[model samples]
Target: MKKVILLSMVTLAMISCNKETQAVEKVKTAYIDTSKLLEENNEAKDIEEKYKVKSEEMGRELRAEASRFQNEAASFQQNAMAKGQAWAQAKGAELQKREQELGMKQQAMLQTLQQESGKEMDSLVKRIKDYVKDYGKKNGYDYIYGTGDAATVLYAKEAYDITTTISKELNDKYKGSEKKEEAPKEEAKK
Candidate 1:
């Protein structure tokens, strides 16, 4: 009778252990391709387009200023012989000063662009991280890893890739948020 009870208890213990193992195995894990997420992400694209336009505008402004300076330089060169050494030297010095000022302005504009872009990119990263955190919470995922060229995760099953799923969700959410922003402006215009 003791042998029978011992066997039953061992069987029960084995079954319970198996159940616990299955429970542990059920932990949800997935990964997103960070590069793909950034590339395909609508918010990221919008930010890029905005910067592209701003860069173009700045380029045009710089070009116009350069053209004006070039015309002055050409005029100075043409009249340098007639204007005498003193006049030519003074004009050259003025042109050099103007060139230096323009160079400084260009540097300032570029620095401003870089600083703004860095801050914006940082904000975008935070936003993405927050979105991912919310997504993990909502989906009951134990882990949602990020992978890319700078891969945090080396290997994961293709079946466990949530890149497409989460990217679509993020884009959809961005679109909805964009509409809300536009609605306020439209109402304000009224």
Candidate 2:
């Protein structure tokens, strides 16, 4: 009787463990390309495009100022050399201070834009996470991972890539939004 009871318990335990392992194997694992997602994400893309256009305009204005300064620099250099070494030393230090101030201002503006862009990127990441939630629910993914930053995942199996599918779906969704926005404008123009 003791031998039979022991055999029964071991059999039950083995059966339960086997079922648990099979359940685990049925789960789908997925890896996401986060860089591609952020780059092609609609909200992030829009912010990036706006930043590019604005920054280009700012750069042109800065370049024009640079040309003006370069022309004036020749005069400053000539005048300073004619004066004593002390005068040149003082002028050079003043010019350097002004340049440093301008550099700091540029740095501030860049930091502001970056902060704004990063916020938008954060929003996009949230959207992707929400999408992944819905996707996991619908398609039965066990684990979906973002592999862009701070990830230990070096390489995932080829079957585990969810980038292209997500990109296509998100791109289509963005196009749908564009159509909705443009519809009223077209009607007004017509």
TM-score to true structure, per model: 0.85, 0.76
Instruction: Please give, for residues 61-146, the per-residue lDDT of candidate 2 as tens digits.
Output: 76776666666667679998689899888878877776776677677777877888788777877887898789877888888887
The Cα error of candidate 2 at residue 96, in Å, is 4.8
TM-score of 1: 0.85
lDDT of 1 at 18: 100
lDDT of 1 by residue, 1-190 (tens): 9999999999999999999999999999999999999999998898888888888899899989999999999999999999899999999999999999999989988888888888888898899999999999998999999999889998899999999998999899999999999999999999
RMSD of 1: 3.5
User: What range of 10 consecutive residues in model 1 has the weakest lDDT sum?
Assistant: 112-121
Q: Identify the candidate with maximal lDDT.
A: 1
Q: How many residue pairs clash in each candidate?
A: 0, 0
Over 4 Å off, model 1: 1-24
The 10 consecutive residues of candidate 2 with the worst lDDT sum are: 65-74
lDDT of each: 0.93, 0.81
In candidate 1, which residue pairs get closer than 3 Å at backbone N, Cα or C atoms, i.e. clash? Answer: none
RMSD of each: 3.5, 3.3
